[model samples]
Target: MSTQEERSGRYLDFYRDNIERISENSSPYINSFRQNAIEEFKKLGIPTRKNESYRYTNLDTFFGHPYSSYFMPSEPDFVKAEEFRCDVTDLDAHGVVLINGFYPTITGKLRELPGGIWIGSLSEASRKFSGMIEQHYGRYVNGNSDGLVHLNTALASDGVFLWIPEGVSLGKPIQIVNLVNSDQDIFNQHRNLIIAEKNSDITLIICDHTLSPQKFLTNAVTEIHVGENAHFNIIRVQNEHNNAAKITHTFIHQERNSVATSNNITLHGGLVRNSTHHYLGGVGAECNSFGLYLSDKFQHVDNYVNVDHAFPSCKSNQLFKGVLDDMATGAFNGRIYVHPDAQGTMAYQKNSSILLTDDAKMDTKPQLEIYADDVKCSHGATVGQLDENALFYLRSRGIDKRQARLMLMFGFAHEVLQNINVEALRERMDNLVMQRLKGELSRCASCMVKCV
Candidate 1:
């Protein structure tokens, strides 16, 4: 067998051997879908460049490493959860922690706050809210053919589950911190479900971090449902070490008159791929997607976005920017699809990147597929170095070369950063971006978990 097939076979054998353990703590409703998902995974296997969606990223390199999968919940350490401090200060938000893809038994399995908000483990929520889980758990990912999605569905045990009741507006944002801390190479898969009921509003902040130097591979899937006239905002911050590979798939469905926004900031990683799918299924639905990535050394980052306009009067906008230094590489793929019956659809996409070194590389593809005649759509991409004219203008004004370059890079990245609605988060991200541009390591200074 070829090397790719050998690597893929490992996972197939793994699922066969651990199927019972994987389903041990899961509910019947969740376990019922595992068999079919694994069958689909067998047909798809691990994705390679042959797959158009995964053309820019080659998963074989990351999957070749031998890593132990986390099938059951690890020993809970509430002390670590309580002692951990978020890099973002003055941001008063509810905190939830997940260690190696399992929610720690911190404060019961589920925590229900005022205003009828539920935040806690997905496995626990599966037992308590079976009706809700059955309705939305696999709904968004039902028709997906991606191997990673199927693999996650087959093996994922627990993750974050959030529910905002109808007509309720959360006073504070929900912050979720996912940490991978282990002595040996580890493979993790976590699934998250978020429901925003009719007329409800909420903001979510997701942070991904690695606390150990061991090789870590994480595959995370999140499904979000926005009810009629509701609003949901999510900001994702990823900061891991060079020995980590992180893959995230997020599926969002918006209902009538609903508004949703997603902002992703990628700081450091060995390999990172973020795939986001947005479905505007109701009239007057709107979504805005933005991302910023900074990478140096041998790191790689990829962002993929697909927006579907299935109803009339829907709108979407995608803007992504990246800064690559040394031998780093990046990719951005943005696609907008408008159905034939969806009239009055407005969609736009743009991707821009700056390469600091001759060896740094970037690949961008912006696509638009519209079947409606009256719809408006546009797409564009740019890959180039910082404008010499701008840099020269700054240097002539008595600014040093290094500082001038940092200023120009930050200015380019600020376009995507400005869209962050949370003032505290925006400021913290701004500082982090500057630090990244100044050649500093992307470690969270205030985080209690130390890396090797």
Candidate 2:
């Protein structure tokens, strides 16, 4: 039998060589950070199925395109983003636009931010505060050892930087709209950072608005730091073209007595992957995570979440719901780890999926490892089809067959969606989900006899 090193493919070797070549080119903008990061990236390289965290996700096949094959469209070519507006009335929110991988200076109107809030480009922030720029740039991200993270950090010449000062609370959500305008086969990597100081409160929304005709790759990373007694909420809505690829990595670090919540909505995409890692670094920290994904056709969506209890008395709760139809595939993995010193920790996790087609694939796993004897922890997962009795009950009410099925499907998914807590955003998601479920219900109703 050949040794492990003998199986190291040429693809890995090419990646390493390219890293060295690019770093040595001496581009002032990227050369300094690139050399050190590239070396670490080579040491880490790409993760294989052997990695427990990615066992269910096949990154090799998912990221088959050459690293240099990503196309860069100059400006807004096919992305007609004017179609998406902040339509909610009486809502005052700041908006920033990113077209393809570059941010548009003249594309979106700019206004003064509320006092005590800093929102702008990372480069701009780097210039204004070099100390902060240096301390947090690569602190939360381990991109050097991860391919997608490495690629994002290496190419993050432009992205967002948001800071909320202490004791300030923004009543309205900050909307950051991402629009992709490029030819087919282009790849985009976006990195964003958010820092909330002690006792500050804020809300943020990330809307993916792109209609690209090509296979677009959006490898994005968002790092959030919640200071002591801070409160924050983040909602991400992804509605991209059918040929687009999406990967999101979000990390939240909480201080003592801090509170953080994140809700992820996968309305539509070709291949979407979402990862959330929360560190309960201080005592009394609380974290909440909820996710919903609706998959159809050849669409593929993967979600992985991990919560770490590094201190005593931390509380965490997680819930995820998935709906898969046609030949689509979806997966969910939620894990919680309690350290030995986290004796008084409290954690709960649950994941459920409703499969509307036998051809559909769904994977659900909930894991827990408690090193503390006094901790309270539990995790569970479920994957099954729609309830026949519920469908019959709805149909018996004289509702249309398609409508009846849609109600049954929505009932299973609404648990997570309703928890959104924001009426406006919740209504928008409700409408999109209505359309998706109705479409699936129509297809399922047509094959109702055969499906049984």
Candidate 3:
């Protein structure tokens, strides 16, 4: 019943012994960065079934696996562009690709971006713009995170760094391809930071591409700093192979009058956990988020979303929906906090899911902590199935039982998908969903829609 830290995990002891050795004071780029993180990781250790946030998912074997550094990647694993293929991409978009958590060679040239925007590798940013990294890195995250986040900071070796100067907007979206293809059991902590100054706009695509059979762990952290009048759209697509385990933390920091839109989509992952936290630090800022998760077979997904309205006149709207079949398990926890100073704030949150199989399980919690009396906020959660009445009506109309079920199920997901603004993304998601409705998505379901 308790979610507090347990005294029995050895990872914490590992951290107590290793934190000082891996302290950043030695130099952010110390060669031992990964080892330092490993020390902290041992201290913080992986979360157990006891941690309130991790109560639904257990990592007994995940942490028990041996750790190996991917710092010096050898020859390319020949799973080149054609084999671990990505769907077609629009050439005009700003594309940034990562292979196995490291930046990869660009086969195609990129068009010149807006004049004031600079997109480069984190190494370049750390060497030239230490000021920015110092001011913003881990600024919004809880510094006391047992050791998961600290390990991420310590072990991070590759990521994207984006900066937008004042008054400039990049209309096209920037795609970040995060690939995982290690030959052995590996743990990679990747970090990315994006800063949008006054009056600029940008969109980011975070894709998880996998092609490895080894047990892998990805603790990815992305920090976004949204300044005055800036607008940002962050889209995350998870399609990792079944053998991968990925945990992500995306932090959004907003200033006055800025807007942040975060879209989380999960189609496949062996064991995926996404933690998205937003801090509305500026007055008049607005935030909107939509998430879609589909889990089948033995896959497991856990999402934790937190929003902190620290200033007045801010607004946020969030909705997360999931579809689970077979023996898959899913969890959703959303928290919105209205601080004492955040008066006149308006916020709404909703979490919903549908389990098609009797063995499928979904647990959702929608929470609100309001310290301000002058705020309007509401939250709701639901777990149910396709409407039997709707199915019956369709069946009465001579529609086949399978077609009727597929239509109703697609209708359920449409509530969340309709909010997407990107036409291509919407179309792609539609196809994936239809694959499910048509019963061509996977083989684990018994009563599935047949796709042509």
Candidate 4:
């Protein structure tokens, strides 16, 4: 067998060997779902390059190294969860911390959630609201088609759970921090569920980081449900050490007149793959996707987005931009699908990149499929180096070549960064991206690794 197949076989064997223990640690009501997912994973195996959706990404290569499951909470390695807090602690947002895919031991100190909202560990939420969790846990995802998602469902132990009752508006954003730290090669799985009832509104910030230099993989899956007339916004930042790999899938389902927005910023990682899907289940639903990736070294970043306008009068807009230097590589695939019943659908997708070095590379694909004749849809992609004229103009005006190039590249990426509604967050990201371009950023200094 080939090396990829061998790695797949090893993962399958590991799952089979640890099935009982994994199930024992999970809630009984979800045990059957977990079993079914594992069986599905066994059938699908790990996705290979041959798979059209995974053409630009190869999970098998990332999984070639042996990685044990996350250590139990009682382990000594998990006792330092408090030291791994995100740098945004001073912000007004409420903080929810997770270490090794589970709630941190210092969770008690978190501010009490406001009325009409429930935020805590997923396991506790499952026990308290089993019916709701059961109805929506795996509703939007297809395990048979994606082995990575199936594996996450089967092995995931805990993550953040949030619920907003009808008509409630959270004035402050909620921050969810995920930290991966271990002494050996380790893999962590996180599953999160967020629900917003009718007329409710919420803003969320998600940050993922690595605390150790050891080889590690973090696979996270999140499902969000937005009720009628609700508004939901999410900002996700992935910054990890070079020895860390990250895979994340986010699914957002919207009801009538609801609006959803997702902003993904990829700052650093050895290998990172992010997939976000939005389903407009009701008329007049809207979704906006914005992303920016800054890469260098041997880093690889892939971003995939699919927006489904299953109902009429729905709309979606996607914009992704990247700046790559050295031998780094990146890919952006954004697809918009409008159904036949979507008579007034409006969809647009755009992907652009700037290569800072001759060795840097990027692949961009933006597509639109509309079954409705009256729909207005458009898609476009562009990849090029910094404009020579703009750089020369800045240099002649007094700026050095380095600063001139940095100015042009930052201008190219600022289009997407401008979409951030949170002022403080936008400022923070601006500094990080600038530092990254100047090669003055370190994983620890960038808030990916905890130094204290």
Best by TM-score: 1
Q: Write the per-residue lDDT of candidate 3 for residues 218-263, one digit (tens) a residue.
A: 8888888998999888888887756678898888989999999998
Clashing pairs in 2: 184-214
TM-score of every model?
A: 0.97, 0.86, 0.87, 0.95
lDDT of 4 by residue, 1-452 (tens): 35655866776777778878777656777677777887777777777878766788867556877786654565454567765556654468887878888876555422347866888888777778888788777777853387888988887877888988899998989888888777778888889989888999999999888877888888889999999999999999888887888999999999999999999999888899999999999999999999999999888999999899999999899999999989999988888888889989999888889888899999887767878888988888899988899989999999999999888888887898888877888888887888888888857463534532
Evaluate model 1: give its lDDT: 0.89
What Cα-based lDDT does every candidate model obtain?
0.89, 0.72, 0.74, 0.83
Q: In model 4, state the lDDT of residue 410.
A: 82
Q: What is the C-alpha RMSD of each candidate to the true structure, in Å?
A: 1.5, 5.6, 5.1, 2.2
Error of 2 at 30 (Å): 8.2
Give the deviation of candidate 1 from the true structure as CA RMSD: 1.5
3 or 4: which has the higher TM-score? Answer: 4
Ranking according to lDDT, highest score first: 1, 4, 3, 2
Residues 309-400 of candidate 1: C-alpha lDDT, one tens digit per residue: 99999999999999999999999989899999999999999999999999999989877888998898888889998899999999999999
For this target, which candidate reaches the highest lDDT against the unseen true structure?
1
- Which parts of model 3 are misplaced by more than 4 Å? 1-43, 75-85, 89-92, 105-112, 142-146, 442-452
Q: Taking the tens digit of each residue's C-alpha lDDT, what string does model 2 give over 78-195?
A: 2444344554444456667666644555443223468678887655565665666665666676432455576566555556778888888988888887876544566676678788
